[model samples]
Each structure stands twice: as structure tokens, then as C-alpha cells.
Target: MNEGDERALKVAVLGCGAVGSQVVRLLTEQRDDLAARVGAPVELVGVAVRRLDAPREVDVPAGLLTTDATELVSRGDVDVVVEVIGGIEPARSLILAALDNGASVVTANKALLAEDGPTLFEAAAKAERDLYYEAAVAGAIPILRPLRESLAGDRVTRVLGIVNGTTNFILDRMDTSGAGFSEALEEAQELGYAEADPTADVEGFDAAAKAAILASLAFHSRVTASDVHREGISEVTAADVASARDMGSVVKLLAICELRPGPDGQDQVAARVHPAMIPRSHPLASVHEAYNAVFVESEAAGQLMFYGPGAGGAPTASAVLGDLVTVARNRLDGTRGAGESAYADRAVQPMGETRTRYHVAIDVDDRAGVLAAVANAFADHDVSIQTVRQEGRGADAQLVVVSHSAPDSALSATVEQLREMDIVREVTSVMRVEGDAE
Candidate 1:
């Protein structure tokens, strides 16, 4: 190979769908800028697609498209592999093959990363190659890089945010328009904010994947999707939204990861994705529509917020390109970026042991001793009540109780016991309270 060819970094993209096409566009349109930034030419060597004739959003040059992803990444001349083909099997195998073949990788596969990130990270480490995946967590918001790079020196205590755009859009609609969960979800589908199935986003699988990624980065530990406690927002009713409004709050599906003490007094990781009521004044509560925001709390940094378009073909592609430039530059420099940081390797706390506040609304008999009985149920589980409000009189009576921070298991037991109580007419709504106290 000539000196010019040796200096030029060859990039193989292993997908030609939404994100893949946009990546191709940026690589072609910003070729000059990318070359300058990398201190060398960046070339799109090949694009691996499932179908050659399939229509694409961007025009991939002739002779660059291929159906064989393995062959494309295995080519000796390929210096960088960008894997936009999301999923576990093929994407994982292709990425591993690329790293083994001595090429750095940039991927936007959150599910793969969340499920089996350590495998990819180990592969890259063994090959002495960079594995940059800033696009995996929050799209163009740049949260992963900050957690991996910028905030490396700071001790992050907690990571909380609305990381899923589909669920956020649905919840935002429900909050703003008093739409039921089904109605809001329908509107989201109509607007293209949600998929036809919508199971992944609405059922909290998407956010759980993202939560695992965030927990791994923030705590410098290995966290997987199974370790994350997930709860979908499909059960959120219009009455729940109205209840939140009455309390000066709004409901949002949140990805929360925290570092807390374990039973042995050692630090443990607690990561959960669920719908919760947050004060309107909170940063995450203000995140509306399809936008994403992450609020970070650390020992030295105090508080930091990263916000932007959480997902979209173009926005995600922007992150992929950013990582591409970084990996390409590293290739030219004969250096590698930071691999996975699992030095802490903390234990993942059980969902039952995790601590948080709860808002429980219960319909009860409008007779004497109802308040005492409810308070006793909470006390029986060692759950402390922070505030209580009673509405209506006689048969129309309802008791809304918000609790102080307590173990989730204890709060859950209290709610269960309340359900069995004869004095309790019905458990109207139960939601975890976050951000602020009443």
C-alpha cells in the first residue's frame, strides 16, 4: 500500500438502516473536516446491508455495499468498524470479529451493550483496540462520554433521568392533556414517537437497557439488563396523572442508578427503571415531549444535567460519527481510548432492598380509626409516613399517604397489607415519589 493509503483509515459500516445511512451521509459530506480532525483521510470502505436493493435514506456509493458483514469487517485494510446493526447475535459476533481483526469499533447498540457489554469490552481490551459507544446511552446528548471521561475524577453518587423518548412522549401527553395511557400511546404511535409494537419502549425494556449502561458507567461496575429492576408505564391511569397534578408533580418513567451501602457496609449498586412521580420543579419532570435529560449527582461536581434529543436516526448517527472521529484519530495516533471501567465491581442491590419514597392513595371507610389503622400498617413495616391528606367525607373518603425514604420491600409489604385490610375499600393509585417531599 502507498503511504497515502496507509495513512487513510478505512471504515466499514455494518448496517444500512436509519442510523447507518445517516452515518454514511456525514462521512461523505464531512470527509474533509473528518480528515483534518483525524490528521488523516477517513474512507468508507464498505457498508454491510441485509438487502442490496433495499431503499436507503442516504446514497451509499456504488461498489461499497455488501451483504456479508463478516467479510467486510474481516478485511485486513479496514481500520475502523462502525456497527449500527443493533441486536445481540450478529452485531455482537461482527463487533468481536472486527476487534479480533485489529480494528477499533464504534457502535450504537444499547441492547447488546446492556446484555453483554463485558464481552465486547474484553474483546477490545485483548486486541488493544478502542471500543467507543457514546451513542449507546443517550443519543447525541453525550452522557456516556461524560460519565466515562469528563466525570472520571469525580465520584458520582446517583444517576437519574428520563432516558426513553417514546415513554416520555406518552407520559408527557398524558400529563399535559389528561389522556389515558392507551390514548397517549396511540397519539405517540400516530406521531412516530412510538413503534407499532411499542412493547420495548412502553414496557420499560428500552429504558432498562439504558439504565444498565448508565449504571455500568457511573459506578464503574458491570451491570446487565437482568440486574435492572424494571416497571412499565402501561398501568399509569389518567387518575394517576390527575393525582400527580394535585400534588404539584408530574409522572415520568425514570432510569435511576445509585451507589448505596450494602448489608456488609460495602458500597452496592442500585439500578431501576420505572414510572415515578417527580416534582414539577425537578429537572427531569420538566423534560417534555421526546427530549431526554439526565441529572447527575456527585460528591465534588454537586449536580450536573445532560439534555438533548434522546433518539432519532440523525441524532444517534451524530453520536456514532463523533465516536468514529475519535476512534479514527486514535488509530492514527497509535493509541486506544479507555476500555470498560469495572474497577469498582460493586454488587447490584436487590429491588426489594432499594430505598425510595412512595405515594399511596387508598379508598377507605369514612369511619373512626381509619387513619390510625393505615398509619399502623405503615408502622408495622417500619415505613415512615412523610405526609397524609384526607379528601371527601363518609363513603366518598380517600386517604393519600406519601412516605419518607424507606426500603422498597417494606413499602411494598405495607401496600399489600393495606390491600387486604377490610377498612380499605380499594387501593386507588400507588406510585413511587421522587425528586422532592410534599
Candidate 2:
């Protein structure tokens, strides 16, 4: 091999799936540009797959393809290992081994990172290697680096984002087409935005994983996937969309992470992923289809947003390549990148401690004083209604009240009081309203 190729940083791609193929394709196609940028050529040393006989997309040599992922990761020739085989199993194990064997790592597996980030990060730190995963969250949007580097000196108070393209596409279609949940999901699957078994995407699991990562980075604390309270878009109906539209708003799945004061005068972080009502004028409401946007509210920077394609082979590959370049530079310099933040390891506040506005739809007796009674219930709990709308007069009337920012305890008490009222039939929906006009 030539001196340029010999000294080039060698990368092994584990899992030649949809995302892995793109990584290989880019490394080959953009070799000249990447080499110029890095001041040295980067080479793809090997490609690992579950099946050696699987049809491939890239023009990689068959000899370079192998089913031995463990062997590939531990090879001494591999300088950096990119793990795209998502999940908690062999991906996690292989990543740990890659770092143990003195190789840097770039991963697109959000699930693995969300679950075992602390362990893996510690492993890399011990090895004095870089473990970068910008592709793991908000694909191609360049979120993690900004949170880790650009905004590292600033204090971020809140991060509310539309991080999942699949659910965002489904919700956007439902709002515009007035389609029910199932119909919108069906269309999303057909259009390749969602998988056939889309439980992970539609059920808010995917967004929750991203939320955990964002929360941890923004707060400089450790937040796990289990710490987030997740609610899916499965229950959103056409009626819900119409209700939001009537109020000049739209429905979107939001991953929200905020650091607020607790009772002890200390900072407490709250992380959650759920479907909520966002005003039509909000920036995120305009984000449609398989795109991602993260709105950050910082104490110093005020309001800022990062938006782009959140997923896809090329978009994801772009993020991986960026990390690869940075890590390669750090490796050559004999220095490691920034490690996890152990500063301000604040408590993850319970869901009940998270205070926000609420929109409640209740089926009430269409009588004259029913509205007054409902309003009194909210007043009893010290929750003030920002707006109230009553529809369908007579015995089948429904009372919809949107409350201003209030304590979660008070909101829960108001709901309980409404449930106890004899005139109230059922609570149709009770959703949090975020991104209110400031």
C-alpha cells in the first residue's frame, strides 16, 4: 500500500444495512474531499454483516465482507469502528470491544446509547478514545455536537424538539388530511416513513430515546430512557386534530427536556416525550413530514432552533462522517475528545413535579350552569383557565378549557374534581399545550 493509504485512518463498518451501506458509499465516493479535509485519506477496512450471503449495495470487495462482527471490531488494523446494528445486544457488546481494543467509535444506535451510554462512555474514557454519536439523535441535524461543544459554555434551560420523523410525518398528515390515527399511520408506513411494525416509532419509544440523550447532554447529567415519561400518538383521533385546528393549533409529538427549580432550591431536570398541542404560529408547527427540529431556550442565547432532515441513509451518514473526521483528528493529535459531564448530576424530577399548561376536553351536561361548575372546579384547584369553548348545546354539550401555566398537582386536582361532578360524562382528552406565545 502507498504511504498515504498506509497512514490513513482505517474504519470498519459493522452492519451493512441501510445506514451502513451509505457510510461505505460516502467513504469511497467522497474520498478526495474527505482526505483534503482531514489532511489524510480515510479507508474502509472491512464491512460486517449478519449474513455473508446477503445482497450488497456498495461495490465493496467480497473478501472485505464478513459475518464475524466480533473479529472485525477487535482487529488491530481497524482504527475506528462504526456500529449501525441498532439495539441493546451485540451492538453494545461490539462497541465496548472496539473501544477496548484501542479504536474510536461512531454509532447511530440511539436505543443503545439511551440505555447504556454511561457504561459505554466510561469505557471509552478509560481507553482514552473517542466515542461519538451525533447520528444517534436528530439524524443529520447536528444537535449533539452543538450541545456538547458550541453551547457547552452556555446554560440551556429547555430543549423541546420534534425528534422523530416517523411520528412527525404521521401527525402532520393526520392534521392536514383530517385522517384518523390508523389511516395516517398506514400512509406513513406505505411511504416508508414508518416501518411495518411501527410500535417503536408511533408509541413514542423512539422519541423518548432521543429525549434522554438530549436531556443528558443539555443538562450535563445522566438521563436514561427509563427516566422519561412516554406517551404515543396512537390515541390521537381526527376529532383531536379538528379540535386543535379550531383553536388555531396543530398536534405534534414533542420531546421536552427542561431544568427547573425544585422544592429544595436545587435544579431538577424533567424529561418527557408525548403528543401535545402546539399553536399554529409556533415554528415547530410548520415543520412537516419526515423532518426534525429542535427548539432550544437558553438563559443566554434566548430562543434558537436547529432544523433539517432527521433521518435517511445519506443524512445519517453525513453525521457519522462528521464525527469520524473529528475523532480521527483527536486520535492523531494523541488527545481524546470531551467526555461525559459529571457536573450537576441533578435529580430527574418526577412527572408530577413538571408544571405546564393543559387543554382539557370534557363531555358535560349541556345545562346552563355546567360551564360555571366546570370553571369553579378549576378555580378550586387554583388553576386559571386561559380560554373556554362550549360546543353542541343541550344535553350533549362538551366543554373545552385551555388552562394557563399551572402546577401539575393543581391540574390533576382539577381533573379529579371534574370527574366527580355529576354533570360531567367523560374526559375526552387532557393534553399539555406547549410553545405558547411568549
Candidate 3:
């Protein structure tokens, strides 16, 4: 074995489930190549695991597995710590310890970042170490780097993405197979697209976390998971999917982040995750299965689309490795890569102030005056109706209305007013419309 001119950089990977095992393989198998890229051979110092005897996808080298995560980060010899642990407490404490101990940290923990990213960034900054999390959102799409670096000069106006693979798979199943929500979810669980306890994915918590991250990067704001207005796809019915199809659209769960001027003239961020209808011809509507795609709109870049495999052990590991190499190179060069750039620090706008179009389906009396009354209801709320499609007649009649872009509050108020109308029997569905020009 030839000793490279540059000293080897020791890497500690915390957690050894699916992604961890792959990280170990890449670090070992690609050592020579990675060494060339980083100008230093990157060695896997140890892997922190709960159980040393658990089965793994890749073989761990001798004497590399340990149960002491705290001690691993605090070893004081590690140069880069890669954290794949997904939660808040232990992951947060370990990452803080790693940065505090003079080690650059690379993490794919979206939850920790979205919940308390600024704290981690501050710690890394105080320690003058690099912190990169390209794998936290959109898996291997490389969206974060583009937002945080490539488009750093440009003003990013919006980031619309299908960030969650589980919901995307279920929605794609509902559209393609004409299956209902429950049946589609069951199939997703069976196929490993969704987990047995999939509340995080299906209920929009996962997408919201990703949304917070995207909003922060795209708008240079401090957006957290709690700041996001979340509406899950659990309320997405088969009828909603059918309605989308009828309008030459498709139903998909979307994480939308926008930067618009606030009342006092400073740019504000509006971040939300929900099920929305997108036109079939749109780029995002075509993203199917468990794949993820982010459509970024910026002033200088115009329009850019990032599409690829979003999740699974391998693809996500690929993103983790990308960050690892960059951080490793920085480590070897005695310099540091970019940390969080929340320098802009724009305000996060509430959901009611966000402007968007809406698709509303109402069951109303088929008799005269109902249509006029509903139109009046929309007008009263300052909501402009874009298109109206009527179905059946009399008691079984349905009035499908798509509204022009308006303040979300106005749309909600209009729906509430419609619900109180004597002629309106039921509000079958009310969904935000996206990916189509009004």
C-alpha cells in the first residue's frame, strides 16, 4: 500500500441501516478514487450502530462497528462526521458535538435541519467547520447545491417540487390504475414505497420538512417546519384525482416555496405542502412513481428542472457521498466549504397571504339561481372564477369551479360562504391548482 502525500482523512458514519451500509461500501471500495479526488485518502474510522450483529447490505470491515455514537463523534481524531440518523435529539446532540470537537459534519437529517437548522449552522460557524446536507431534500437531484451555490447570485422566486416519494407513488398509482386512495396506499406499503406507519409521509410532515429546507435555501430565509402551512394528501380522494384528469390535469403532492414582497417592501417567504392539481402538459405533472423533481424559477436562470430517483438506500447514499467528497476536499485543503447562508433572513409569510388558484367542486341544486348565487359568493369574497364545469342535473348536480390566482384567505372564505348557502348541498372537493398558467 502506497501512502499518499496528503494525510488520510478519517470519516465516522453514524447509523448503519440502509444508507449507512452503502456509505461504508463507497468509502472502502472507492477509497483510491476518492483519495485522488480529495487529495487525501478518506478512511472509514468507525460506524455507530445500535446492534453490532444486525444484518447489513454491505460487509463492515473488522472492528468498525460500535454502539457508542457519542464517543464516536467525540473521538477527537475524526475529520468529517457523516450523520444519517433521521431524528432530532441524538442526531442533533451528536452533530453539535462533532462540530464542537473540530470535525466538519455532513448530514442527511432533514428533520433536525428543518426543525433547528440555524442552531447547527451557528455551531459549525463558531467552530469554523463545514456543514453540508445535500441529501436532506430531493434525494440525489442536486437541488440544494444549485440553490445554495449556483443560484446564490440570482434571486430565486419560487421552488415547486414533488419532494416526497411515498406520496408521489401513491398519487401516481391512484391516477394510473384508477385506484382509490386507500387501495393505492396499501399497494405502496406492499411495494415498499410507503412504510407500515406512513403517517409522516402521507400526512405531509415529510414534505413540509423538505419545504422548510427549500424555502430557506431558495429565499435565503429562516423557515422552519412549524412555519410551514401543511395540508396532507390523506384528504386526497379518488374523486379529486378524477377531477384533475377531467381537466387534463393530475393530482400530486407538492412542496411550494415562494419569495414575494411583503407589506414593508422586504421579500417574504411562503412555504407550504399539500395536494394540488397540475396540468398534464406541465413538467411536474409528468413526474411519476416514487421519483422526485424540483422546478426552480429564478430571475437569472429563468426555469430549471431537476429530475431523478428521489429515495432508496443507493440514490440517497449517492447524495451523501457527494457532500462527503466536497467536505473532504475542503478538509484536506485546510479551507472550508460554504455553510448556511441565511444572511437575507426574510420574513416567513402565513398561508392566508399566499396567492394561488383553487379548484372547487360543489354539489348544488340543479335549478336556476344556484349558479348565479355561487358566482356571487365568489365575487363577494373577491375571488375570480376562471372556469366552471357542470355535471348531471337537479339534486345530483355538481358545480366544478376553478378560480383565478387570489389570496388563499379569500378562497377559504369563499368556500366557507358557499358551505352556508341554502342551494349548495355539499362541498365535494376544494384543492389548490398549480403548474398551469391562469
Query: Could you give candidate 3's per-residue lDDT for residues 140-229 as a string of tens digits?
Result: 889999998999889899999999999999999999999999999999999999999999999999999999999998887789999999
lDDT of 1 by residue, 342-418 (tens): 99989999999999999999999999999999999999999999989999998999999999999999999999999
Task: Count the clashes in each prediction.
Answer: 0, 0, 0
Positional deviation of residue 323's Cα in model 1 after best superposition, in angstroms? 0.5
List CA RMSD, all candidates. Answer: 1.6, 2.0, 1.8
CA displacement after TM-score superposition, residue 125 of candidate 2 (Å): 0.6
Off by over 4 Å in 1: 1-6
Measured against the true structure, the TM-scores of the candidates, in listed sequence, are 0.98, 0.97, 0.98
- For residue 321, model 2's alpha carbon misses the true position, in angstroms, by 0.6
Candidate 3 — which residues are off by over 4 angstroms?
A: 1-5
C-alpha positional error of residue 248 in candidate 1 after TM-score superposition, expressed in Å: 0.6
Alpha-carbon shift of residue 183 in model 2 (angstroms): 0.6
- Candidate 3 has a TM-score of 0.98
lDDT of each: 0.93, 0.90, 0.92
